[model samples]
Target: MRYLRFTNWLTEIDRMSGPISAIWFEEVRRHAGTDAAHVYGGLMATLTAWAELRGVPCEGVPVGTIKRHATGKGNAPKHAMIEAARARGFDPVDDNEADAIALLLWAIETKGGLA
Candidate 1:
């Protein structure tokens, strides 16, 4: 049921966004609990499979890499990431939003603004 909901959400986003050039996600190396780890793995597998079915490029960025790219610190805290996004002219409402913004920026910069 959860996987279905997640795929439905992805479909909704794809419909709204038009053609997806690529997909990027944060690659978490560790989880505090086994259940969380399992959930992450399941979601990741679902996401990759979905992307593959659609022929879209899907990649994972490391947590430390995102933090360093956003705030010049590999282990930057949530508040620092938020500040970094704000500095980049984004008003993120939460850490997740901020992280997304940071990842977008990273992708754009790394891919020479064509991504």
Candidate 2:
């Protein structure tokens, strides 16, 4: 359902602009149960469907990985991610959304593509 909403949003965004490089799923696990494998698989499917629909690129990365890469520690605190976000050249007001976007960009850079 969330994935579907995201795809819809992406499609709407695409309609306004041109195809983009990727999509970001922030704290995606929070939206799932204890089933990690199922969550990841569902993520892949959602991304694939979104990519196919928009003819754009897409990828998914865990929120913690983003915090780790952005903040240094895999289990860094939120304040740490906030500090790191500022240090990384983003304004403080942009922390949450920017962190999410950064996480998505990191995933896209890491993965080849949605396919």
Best by lDDT: 1
* 10 residues in a row with least lDDT, candidate 1: 106-115
Model 2: residues with Cα > 4 Å off, grouped in runs: 1-8, 31-48, 104-115
Q: In order, what lDDT does every prediction score?
A: 0.90, 0.66
Clashing pairs in 2: none
* Residue range 28-98, candidate 2, lDDT tens digits: 65544567767667767877886877666445566677776676677777677777767767766646765
Instruction: Point to the candidate with the largest TM-score.
Output: 1
- lDDT string for model 1 (20-59, tens) is 7799899899999999999999999999998999999999
Model 2 superposed RMSD (Cα)? 4.9
